[model samples]
Target: MKKLFFLPILFLLFACNGNAQKKSSDKAEEKFEVTKTEQEWKEELTEAEFQVLRKAATERPYSSELNDITEAGVFVCAACGNELYRSEHKFDSGTGWPSFDRAIEGGVAYGSDSKLGYQRNEVHCARCGGHLGHVFDDGPRETTGKRHCINGVAMDFIPDDTK
Candidate 1:
């Protein structure tokens, strides 16, 4: 009886470990259009920007000024200046970070993130492969019904001439 119980626990442990390893290895094989050395990226980006954009870290909620801006313009990747979310798609999801209903076509990519022990749809910069944030299904029903909760540190806002 003891041997049987131990076997099942061991199997469960190995199964969980294997899944984690597979996810990480698959992410490692991915390539982006704008690639750079870690040192080169560190030199170009500020410490905070590097953390969020390169290391997949989250910023403090409501800490970014971009959350307050309602101007008409575009939000682009800070790493590569690739156009991402447009002002028209942005909304106050009240999550502190800049939230968007949609991204500019083909400007962003999605990946799986289970870092927090649960599955999440990870968002990335398609041009540079920088981690932007996560997307959730809880959003406005009037539109795409997707909430793209993004870190402002990973992006730069460009106000339109009219704004």
Candidate 2:
């Protein structure tokens, strides 16, 4: 009898959380200027990239080549070529993902994520609305105090011009 009573409450809680995430995603998508069909995105991105960017799936940590890059460059959206973070802001968070203390102005947007049964700030391309990753408070305190934990699959590094 106790289990039965608690089951309905659990279901309602999870159900409401899912709907809230969906609505939040919808609102974020609506603000994006560059819209694409699912087929178009799939055709453009690789299977791994597609999973991370389109489906919000995370790539294996420390598996990204970008994790080792030390060149001064710009990190752009792999889906739309919008500059999101600069190399100067990049840091080794030791979490295996590319971590930036801050994102470029107007480059990315935040949305509430509850995929882990708790709220997280989701990071996505402002132009295309593709999922990049999540941001957390654990970062370099000298800077923004934000660990913009991003997926390398969602980014492309453009080397800086040595002029």
Candidate 3:
């Protein structure tokens, strides 16, 4: 019985090791290098962007203009103007923050967040280490089971030309 248990535990350890190695490999492939200085970012972004992106400050709940915005456009990073979310994925989560069901491909990156003694999926700009938001697994089934909880100050909405 001890031998049997040992074998299963060894197999589980190997599986976990394999998964960890794969993730490190994946991060190495996807990791982006920041190429801008603080002054450059400050010149490019407004005071709000500096606070939310660089300082990792959270905006007040229910204080984002994008929460009620129902326009057809792309939301770009306020710091670097990297296209982050599209209008199609925007949704009302009633969470008092700008919520999105999806993200623009290659626009955002995910990492483990351990702040406040809780682990979460921390979403940041792919081009910059600017904090965009946190992602949750509970979302509408019609969409991906992902809810990107973002701050309004982190994004700049660009209305579609039709508007």
Candidate 3 error regions (>4 Å): 1-34
Residue 113 C-alpha lDDT in model 2: 77
- Please give, for residues 1-163, the per-residue lDDT of candidate 1 as tens digits: 9999999999988888767576632345778889999999999999999999999999999999999889899999999999999999999998999999999999999888888988899999988999999999998999999999999999999999944
lDDT of 3 by residue, 1-163 (tens): 8999899889988888653344321233454566567788788777877888876778999998889889899999887778999988989898999999999999998876555556678788898668888899887788798899999999989999844
Instruction: Output the TM-score of candidate 3.
Output: 0.76
As for candidate 2, its clashing pairs are none
Q: Judged by lDDT against the true structure, how good is candidate 1?
A: 0.91
Backbone clashes in model 3: 0
Q: What are the Cα lDDT values of the candidates?
A: 0.91, 0.90, 0.82
Model 2 residue 52 lDDT? Answer: 91
Model 2 reaches what TM-score against the true structure?
A: 0.84
Candidate 1, run of 10 with poorest lDDT: 20-29
Rank the models by lDDT, top first: 1, 2, 3
